[model samples]
Target: MDHPPRIYCYRCRKPDLLCICADVTPVPTRFGIVILQHPQESRRTISTARIVSLSLTGARLFVGLDFAGCTALHSHLAAAPGPVYLVYPERGALDVVDVMAREHGWPDGAPTFVIIDGTWAQARKIKNQNPCLDRFERVSLSPGAPSRYRIRRQPRGHYLSTVEASVLLLSRLEGSEEAFRPLLEVFDRMIDRQLSFKSGESRRGVRRPAPRPEGG
Candidate 1:
Protein backbone atom coordinates (compact mmCIF):
# COMPACT_ATOMS: atom_id res chain seq x y z
CA MET A 1 0.00 0.00 0.00
CA ASP A 2 2.61 2.51 -1.00
CA HIS A 3 0.38 5.33 -2.31
CA PRO A 4 2.20 8.40 -3.55
CA PRO A 5 1.96 11.70 -1.70
CA ARG A 6 -0.58 14.03 -3.34
CA ILE A 7 0.96 17.05 -4.99
CA TYR A 8 -0.86 20.24 -4.05
CA CYS A 9 -1.17 23.64 -5.67
CA TYR A 10 0.30 26.15 -3.26
CA ARG A 11 -1.89 29.01 -4.50
CA CYS A 12 -5.26 27.34 -3.99
CA ARG A 13 -4.02 24.72 -1.53
CA LYS A 14 -5.87 22.02 -3.49
CA PRO A 15 -4.45 18.90 -5.04
CA ASP A 16 -3.16 19.49 -8.57
CA LEU A 17 -6.04 17.48 -10.04
CA LEU A 18 -8.66 19.50 -8.15
CA CYS A 19 -6.85 22.82 -8.28
CA ILE A 20 -9.04 25.92 -8.78
CA CYS A 21 -6.18 28.26 -9.51
CA ALA A 22 -7.13 28.51 -13.18
CA ASP A 23 -10.76 29.38 -12.46
CA VAL A 24 -9.90 32.28 -10.16
CA THR A 25 -10.82 35.50 -11.94
CA PRO A 26 -10.35 38.35 -9.48
CA VAL A 27 -13.33 40.58 -8.90
CA PRO A 28 -12.81 44.10 -7.61
CA THR A 29 -15.06 45.05 -4.73
CA ARG A 30 -16.06 48.31 -3.12
CA PHE A 31 -15.91 47.04 0.46
CA GLY A 32 -13.20 45.11 2.25
CA ILE A 33 -13.92 41.43 2.92
CA VAL A 34 -12.08 39.92 5.88
CA ILE A 35 -12.70 36.18 6.15
CA LEU A 36 -11.72 34.69 9.51
CA GLN A 37 -11.64 30.99 8.65
CA HIS A 38 -11.45 28.30 11.28
CA PRO A 39 -8.14 26.43 10.97
CA GLN A 40 -9.85 23.11 10.28
CA GLU A 41 -11.84 24.53 7.38
CA SER A 42 -8.66 25.81 5.79
CA ARG A 43 -7.44 22.25 5.27
CA ARG A 44 -10.55 21.10 3.41
CA THR A 45 -10.15 20.39 -0.30
CA ILE A 46 -13.35 22.22 -1.27
CA SER A 47 -12.76 25.39 0.71
CA THR A 48 -14.81 28.24 -0.84
CA ALA A 49 -13.13 30.67 1.52
CA ARG A 50 -10.08 30.15 -0.64
CA ILE A 51 -12.17 31.00 -3.72
CA VAL A 52 -13.49 34.17 -2.16
CA SER A 53 -9.98 35.16 -1.18
CA LEU A 54 -8.60 34.35 -4.61
CA SER A 55 -11.48 35.84 -6.62
CA LEU A 56 -11.86 39.10 -4.77
CA THR A 57 -9.08 41.61 -4.75
CA GLY A 58 -10.41 43.15 -1.54
CA ALA A 59 -10.72 39.85 0.29
CA ARG A 60 -8.27 38.85 3.07
CA LEU A 61 -8.21 35.40 4.65
CA PHE A 62 -7.07 34.84 8.22
CA VAL A 63 -6.95 31.30 9.59
CA GLY A 64 -7.37 30.85 13.35
CA LEU A 65 -9.66 29.62 16.08
CA ASP A 66 -9.26 32.75 18.18
CA PHE A 67 -8.24 36.15 16.94
CA ALA A 68 -7.79 37.84 20.30
CA GLY A 69 -4.10 38.62 19.82
CA CYS A 70 -3.86 38.61 16.04
CA THR A 71 -1.88 41.69 15.04
CA ALA A 72 -3.14 41.63 11.47
CA LEU A 73 -6.71 41.45 12.68
CA HIS A 74 -6.32 44.49 14.87
CA SER A 75 -4.42 46.38 12.19
CA HIS A 76 -7.12 45.60 9.60
CA LEU A 77 -9.81 46.81 11.95
CA ALA A 78 -7.90 50.03 12.65
CA ALA A 79 -7.30 50.71 9.00
CA ALA A 80 -10.89 50.19 7.85
CA PRO A 81 -11.96 53.18 5.71
CA GLY A 82 -15.36 53.27 7.39
CA PRO A 83 -17.20 51.55 10.22
CA VAL A 84 -16.50 47.82 10.69
CA TYR A 85 -19.35 45.33 10.50
CA LEU A 86 -19.57 41.64 11.30
CA VAL A 87 -21.79 39.57 8.98
CA TYR A 88 -23.26 37.15 11.46
CA PRO A 89 -26.90 36.37 12.21
CA GLU A 90 -27.32 37.56 15.76
CA ARG A 91 -30.33 38.71 17.77
CA GLY A 92 -31.32 42.11 16.38
CA ALA A 93 -28.77 41.88 13.58
CA LEU A 94 -29.78 44.53 11.06
CA ASP A 95 -30.41 43.79 7.42
CA VAL A 96 -27.52 44.92 5.23
CA VAL A 97 -29.75 46.86 2.83
CA ASP A 98 -31.79 48.45 5.59
CA VAL A 99 -28.65 49.59 7.35
CA MET A 100 -27.89 51.71 4.32
CA ALA A 101 -31.30 53.40 4.48
CA ARG A 102 -31.21 53.87 8.28
CA GLU A 103 -27.90 55.62 8.09
CA HIS A 104 -29.09 57.67 5.06
CA GLY A 105 -26.51 55.74 3.04
CA TRP A 106 -22.75 55.78 3.14
CA PRO A 107 -21.77 58.12 0.31
CA ASP A 108 -18.11 57.24 0.52
CA GLY A 109 -16.97 53.95 2.05
CA ALA A 110 -19.19 51.15 3.29
CA PRO A 111 -18.10 49.27 6.39
CA THR A 112 -15.63 46.46 6.09
CA PHE A 113 -17.37 43.06 6.32
CA VAL A 114 -15.91 40.41 8.58
CA ILE A 115 -17.25 37.01 7.56
CA ILE A 116 -16.61 34.05 9.87
CA ASP A 117 -16.11 30.94 7.75
CA GLY A 118 -17.05 27.78 9.67
CA THR A 119 -19.94 25.76 10.98
CA TRP A 120 -22.54 27.53 13.12
CA ALA A 121 -20.99 26.17 16.31
CA GLN A 122 -17.47 27.03 15.22
CA ALA A 123 -18.56 30.50 14.15
CA ARG A 124 -20.04 31.09 17.60
CA LYS A 125 -16.79 29.95 19.17
CA ILE A 126 -14.73 32.34 17.03
CA LYS A 127 -16.94 35.32 17.85
CA ASN A 128 -16.93 34.56 21.56
CA GLN A 129 -13.16 34.15 21.58
CA ASN A 130 -12.58 37.36 19.70
CA PRO A 131 -13.92 39.94 22.15
CA CYS A 132 -12.49 42.72 19.99
CA LEU A 133 -15.19 42.03 17.38
CA ASP A 134 -17.89 42.89 19.92
CA ARG A 135 -17.38 46.57 19.18
CA PHE A 136 -18.69 46.24 15.62
CA GLU A 137 -22.33 46.18 14.57
CA ARG A 138 -23.59 42.80 13.44
CA VAL A 139 -25.49 42.66 10.15
CA SER A 140 -27.09 39.74 8.36
CA LEU A 141 -28.06 39.34 4.73
CA SER A 142 -31.58 38.74 3.48
CA PRO A 143 -31.60 35.25 1.92
CA GLY A 144 -31.29 35.35 -1.81
CA ALA A 145 -31.34 32.48 -4.32
CA PRO A 146 -31.24 29.14 -2.55
CA SER A 147 -27.80 27.82 -1.82
CA ARG A 148 -26.23 25.92 -4.71
CA TYR A 149 -24.11 23.91 -2.28
CA ARG A 150 -25.88 20.65 -3.01
CA ILE A 151 -22.82 18.56 -2.17
CA ARG A 152 -23.53 18.72 1.58
CA ARG A 153 -26.52 18.45 3.88
CA GLN A 154 -27.47 21.94 5.04
CA PRO A 155 -29.76 22.46 7.99
CA ARG A 156 -31.82 24.87 5.93
CA GLY A 157 -32.23 25.93 2.32
CA HIS A 158 -30.84 29.41 2.79
CA TYR A 159 -27.73 28.20 4.49
CA LEU A 160 -25.13 29.30 1.96
CA SER A 161 -21.55 28.29 1.40
CA THR A 162 -18.91 30.88 2.34
CA VAL A 163 -18.46 32.14 -1.20
CA GLU A 164 -22.21 32.03 -1.89
CA ALA A 165 -22.84 34.27 1.10
CA SER A 166 -20.04 36.51 -0.06
CA VAL A 167 -21.62 36.82 -3.49
CA LEU A 168 -24.93 37.94 -2.01
CA LEU A 169 -23.30 40.31 0.49
CA LEU A 170 -20.98 41.99 -1.97
CA SER A 171 -23.36 42.13 -4.93
CA ARG A 172 -26.12 43.74 -2.88
CA LEU A 173 -23.88 46.06 -0.87
CA GLU A 174 -22.30 47.43 -4.03
CA GLY A 175 -25.64 47.52 -5.94
CA SER A 176 -24.21 45.50 -8.80
CA GLU A 177 -25.05 41.83 -9.12
CA GLU A 178 -22.72 41.34 -12.06
CA ALA A 179 -19.45 42.15 -10.27
CA PHE A 180 -19.80 39.43 -7.65
CA ARG A 181 -21.09 36.85 -10.12
CA PRO A 182 -17.58 35.56 -10.71
CA LEU A 183 -17.42 34.35 -7.11
CA LEU A 184 -20.35 32.05 -7.78
CA GLU A 185 -18.91 31.03 -11.10
CA VAL A 186 -15.87 29.68 -9.27
CA PHE A 187 -18.06 28.27 -6.50
CA ASP A 188 -20.18 26.32 -8.95
CA ARG A 189 -17.14 25.11 -10.80
CA MET A 190 -15.68 23.75 -7.58
CA ILE A 191 -18.92 21.97 -6.76
CA ASP A 192 -19.09 20.44 -10.22
CA ARG A 193 -15.50 19.23 -9.98
CA GLN A 194 -16.08 17.65 -6.58
CA LEU A 195 -19.20 15.92 -7.83
CA SER A 196 -17.29 14.65 -10.81
CA PHE A 197 -14.50 13.40 -8.58
CA LYS A 198 -16.98 11.47 -6.46
CA SER A 199 -18.62 10.05 -9.55
CA GLY A 200 -15.28 8.79 -10.70
CA GLU A 201 -14.83 7.08 -7.35
CA SER A 202 -18.33 5.58 -7.50
CA ARG A 203 -17.57 4.21 -10.95
CA ARG A 204 -14.73 2.29 -9.28
CA GLY A 205 -17.40 0.96 -6.85
CA VAL A 206 -16.45 3.01 -3.78
CA ARG A 207 -19.40 2.98 -1.42
CA ARG A 208 -18.61 5.63 1.18
CA PRO A 209 -19.53 9.27 0.88
CA ALA A 210 -16.81 11.88 0.82
CA PRO A 211 -16.24 14.04 3.86
CA ARG A 212 -18.15 17.33 3.93
CA PRO A 213 -16.46 20.24 5.65
CA GLU A 214 -18.56 23.00 7.21
CA GLY A 215 -18.15 26.55 6.00
CA GLY A 216 -20.31 29.68 6.14
Candidate 2:
Protein backbone atom coordinates (compact mmCIF):
# COMPACT_ATOMS: atom_id res chain seq x y z
CA MET A 1 0.00 0.00 0.00
CA ASP A 2 1.15 3.54 -0.77
CA HIS A 3 2.07 5.62 2.28
CA PRO A 4 0.75 9.11 2.88
CA PRO A 5 3.02 11.95 1.86
CA ARG A 6 5.02 13.40 4.75
CA ILE A 7 5.10 17.16 4.90
CA TYR A 8 8.24 18.65 6.41
CA CYS A 9 9.10 22.18 7.42
CA TYR A 10 11.59 23.81 5.10
CA ARG A 11 13.45 25.61 7.86
CA CYS A 12 13.50 23.30 10.91
CA ARG A 13 13.36 20.15 8.71
CA LYS A 14 10.98 18.41 11.09
CA PRO A 15 7.61 17.03 10.00
CA ASP A 16 5.23 19.94 9.31
CA LEU A 17 2.89 19.03 12.15
CA LEU A 18 5.81 19.04 14.60
CA CYS A 19 7.74 21.96 13.18
CA ILE A 20 9.07 24.48 15.72
CA CYS A 21 10.24 26.99 13.13
CA ALA A 22 7.82 29.65 14.28
CA ASP A 23 9.37 29.50 17.73
CA VAL A 24 12.93 30.11 16.57
CA THR A 25 14.34 33.59 17.07
CA PRO A 26 17.99 33.96 16.24
CA VAL A 27 19.96 35.36 19.18
CA PRO A 28 23.09 37.37 18.64
CA THR A 29 26.32 36.57 20.45
CA ARG A 30 29.72 38.21 20.52
CA PHE A 31 31.50 34.85 20.68
CA GLY A 32 31.66 32.70 17.58
CA ILE A 33 30.34 29.13 17.82
CA VAL A 34 31.85 26.24 15.88
CA ILE A 35 29.83 23.04 16.02
CA LEU A 36 31.47 19.85 14.82
CA GLN A 37 28.68 17.34 14.44
CA HIS A 38 29.14 13.61 14.05
CA PRO A 39 27.49 12.11 10.94
CA GLN A 40 25.30 9.85 13.08
CA GLU A 41 24.21 12.68 15.36
CA SER A 42 23.36 14.88 12.40
CA ARG A 43 20.89 12.24 11.24
CA ARG A 44 19.03 12.04 14.57
CA THR A 45 15.52 13.49 14.36
CA ILE A 46 15.68 14.82 17.92
CA SER A 47 19.17 16.26 17.69
CA THR A 48 19.55 19.90 18.84
CA ALA A 49 22.66 20.95 16.95
CA ARG A 50 20.58 22.28 14.06
CA ILE A 51 18.48 24.31 16.46
CA VAL A 52 21.59 25.69 18.15
CA SER A 53 23.03 26.62 14.75
CA LEU A 54 19.83 28.40 13.77
CA SER A 55 19.56 30.22 17.09
CA LEU A 56 23.04 31.74 17.16
CA THR A 57 24.26 34.31 14.67
CA GLY A 58 27.37 33.49 12.68
CA ALA A 59 27.49 29.97 14.12
CA ARG A 60 29.30 27.44 11.93
CA LEU A 61 28.28 23.80 11.64
CA PHE A 62 30.57 21.22 10.06
CA VAL A 63 29.64 17.54 9.75
CA GLY A 64 31.98 14.51 9.66
CA LEU A 65 35.09 13.34 11.48
CA ASP A 66 38.78 14.16 11.32
CA PHE A 67 38.53 17.95 11.16
CA ALA A 68 42.28 18.17 11.65
CA GLY A 69 42.61 18.44 7.88
CA CYS A 70 39.70 20.83 7.35
CA THR A 71 41.32 23.91 5.86
CA ALA A 72 38.30 26.13 6.44
CA LEU A 73 38.09 25.21 10.11
CA HIS A 74 41.81 25.69 10.50
CA SER A 75 41.57 29.14 8.86
CA HIS A 76 38.69 30.13 11.10
CA LEU A 77 40.58 29.02 14.14
CA ALA A 78 43.67 30.93 13.06
CA ALA A 79 41.78 34.14 12.37
CA ALA A 80 39.48 34.13 15.37
CA PRO A 81 39.16 37.58 16.98
CA GLY A 82 40.03 36.29 20.45
CA PRO A 83 41.25 33.20 22.27
CA VAL A 84 39.83 29.90 21.03
CA TYR A 85 38.64 27.33 23.53
CA LEU A 86 37.27 23.84 23.27
CA VAL A 87 34.08 23.31 25.29
CA TYR A 88 34.85 19.93 26.74
CA PRO A 89 35.05 18.64 30.31
CA GLU A 90 38.68 17.63 30.41
CA ARG A 91 40.48 17.40 33.77
CA GLY A 92 42.59 20.51 33.23
CA ALA A 93 39.76 22.55 31.72
CA LEU A 94 38.81 25.78 33.47
CA ASP A 95 35.26 26.71 34.25
CA VAL A 96 33.81 29.42 32.03
CA VAL A 97 33.58 31.91 34.91
CA ASP A 98 37.08 31.13 36.14
CA VAL A 99 38.47 31.52 32.64
CA MET A 100 36.93 34.97 32.53
CA ALA A 101 38.58 35.99 35.80
CA ARG A 102 42.09 34.63 35.30
CA GLU A 103 45.41 36.30 34.34
CA HIS A 104 44.80 39.20 31.91
CA GLY A 105 41.05 39.18 32.50
CA TRP A 106 38.49 38.75 29.67
CA PRO A 107 39.95 39.48 26.28
CA ASP A 108 38.92 42.52 24.27
CA GLY A 109 36.96 40.31 21.84
CA ALA A 110 34.73 37.34 22.61
CA PRO A 111 36.33 33.92 22.73
CA THR A 112 35.47 31.31 20.11
CA PHE A 113 33.83 28.13 21.42
CA VAL A 114 34.38 24.81 19.67
CA ILE A 115 31.56 22.45 20.59
CA ILE A 116 31.49 18.80 19.54
CA ASP A 117 28.00 17.52 18.85
CA GLY A 118 27.62 13.77 19.37
CA THR A 119 27.22 11.01 21.92
CA TRP A 120 29.79 10.95 24.75
CA ALA A 121 31.80 8.22 23.05
CA GLN A 122 31.55 9.90 19.65
CA ALA A 123 32.55 13.23 21.14
CA ARG A 124 35.56 11.61 22.77
CA LYS A 125 36.53 10.05 19.44
CA ILE A 126 36.24 13.40 17.66
CA LYS A 127 38.40 15.09 20.29
CA ASN A 128 40.97 12.32 20.09
CA GLN A 129 41.16 12.31 16.28
CA ASN A 130 41.34 16.07 15.91
CA PRO A 131 44.87 16.79 17.01
CA CYS A 132 44.65 20.39 15.81
CA LEU A 133 42.14 21.15 18.58
CA ASP A 134 44.71 20.24 21.22
CA ARG A 135 46.41 23.62 20.95
CA PHE A 136 43.38 25.58 22.14
CA GLU A 137 42.54 26.08 25.84
CA ARG A 138 39.76 23.86 27.19
CA VAL A 139 36.78 25.13 29.17
CA SER A 140 33.97 23.43 31.09
CA LEU A 141 30.73 24.47 32.75
CA SER A 142 30.19 24.64 36.50
CA PRO A 143 27.68 22.29 38.06
CA GLY A 144 24.17 23.33 37.15
CA ALA A 145 20.65 21.96 37.15
CA PRO A 146 20.05 18.50 35.74
CA SER A 147 19.65 18.23 31.99
CA ARG A 148 16.21 18.94 30.63
CA TYR A 149 16.67 16.66 27.65
CA ARG A 150 14.22 13.85 28.38
CA ILE A 151 13.97 12.10 25.03
CA ARG A 152 17.44 10.56 25.08
CA ARG A 153 19.14 8.83 27.99
CA GLN A 154 22.38 10.62 28.82
CA PRO A 155 25.39 8.73 30.09
CA ARG A 156 25.12 10.91 33.17
CA GLY A 157 22.59 13.35 34.66
CA HIS A 158 24.92 16.35 34.30
CA TYR A 159 25.26 16.10 30.55
CA LEU A 160 23.35 18.84 28.79
CA SER A 161 22.02 18.97 25.28
CA THR A 162 24.16 20.78 22.73
CA VAL A 163 21.69 23.65 22.69
CA GLU A 164 21.46 23.75 26.48
CA ALA A 165 25.21 23.84 26.80
CA SER A 166 25.43 26.63 24.20
CA VAL A 167 22.77 28.67 25.95
CA LEU A 168 24.41 28.24 29.33
CA LEU A 169 27.78 29.23 27.97
CA LEU A 170 26.36 32.24 26.20
CA SER A 171 24.52 33.32 29.31
CA ARG A 172 27.76 33.35 31.25
CA LEU A 173 29.73 35.09 28.48
CA GLU A 174 27.11 37.75 27.86
CA GLY A 175 26.64 38.31 31.63
CA SER A 176 22.89 38.31 31.11
CA GLU A 177 20.90 35.12 31.39
CA GLU A 178 17.81 36.88 29.99
CA ALA A 179 19.28 37.25 26.49
CA PHE A 180 19.62 33.52 25.88
CA ARG A 181 16.29 32.56 27.45
CA PRO A 182 14.42 32.28 24.16
CA LEU A 183 16.68 29.52 22.88
CA LEU A 184 15.87 27.39 25.89
CA GLU A 185 12.18 28.12 25.43
CA VAL A 186 12.35 26.93 21.84
CA PHE A 187 14.25 23.80 22.90
CA ASP A 188 11.70 23.01 25.59
CA ARG A 189 8.85 23.43 23.13
CA MET A 190 10.54 21.13 20.65
CA ILE A 191 10.92 18.45 23.31
CA ASP A 192 7.31 18.83 24.39
CA ARG A 193 6.08 18.50 20.81
CA GLN A 194 8.11 15.38 20.26
CA LEU A 195 6.77 13.86 23.46
CA SER A 196 3.23 14.69 22.36
CA PHE A 197 3.81 13.02 19.02
CA LYS A 198 5.07 9.86 20.72
CA SER A 199 2.02 9.86 23.00
CA GLY A 200 -0.30 10.11 20.02
CA GLU A 201 1.37 7.14 18.35
CA SER A 202 0.91 5.10 21.52
CA ARG A 203 -2.74 6.08 21.76
CA ARG A 204 -3.19 4.85 18.19
CA GLY A 205 -1.75 1.48 19.31
CA VAL A 206 1.28 1.77 17.03
CA ARG A 207 3.69 -0.62 18.65
CA ARG A 208 7.38 0.23 18.52
CA PRO A 209 9.64 -2.53 17.29
CA ALA A 210 11.46 -4.48 20.00
CA PRO A 211 15.09 -3.74 20.55
CA ARG A 212 17.45 -6.03 18.68
CA PRO A 213 19.87 -8.10 20.74
CA GLU A 214 23.51 -7.16 20.44
CA GLY A 215 25.48 -9.25 17.90
CA GLY A 216 22.31 -11.08 16.87
RMSD of each: 3.3, 2.3
Best model per lDDT? 2
Model 1: residues >4 Å from true position, as ranges? Answer: 103-105, 206-216
Q: Given candidate 2, what's the lDDT at residue 76?
A: 83
Can you tell me which runs of candidate 2 are displaced by over 4 Å?
103-108, 208-216
With candidate 1 superimposed using the best TM-score fit, by how many Å does residue 102's alpha carbon deviate from the native? 3.7
Tens digits of per-residue lDDT, candidate 2, 111-190, equal 89999999999999999998888998899986479888988888887899899899899898778989999888988898
lDDT of 1 at 178: 88
Which candidate achieves the best TM-score against the true structure? 1
What are the per-residue Cα lDDT tens digits for candidate 1 across 1-216? 345687999999998888998988978876889999998788888878999999888789999987888898889888888788899998999897777776565665667889999888888899999888899899998785677887876678778888988888877777888888877888888889999998997898757646677462
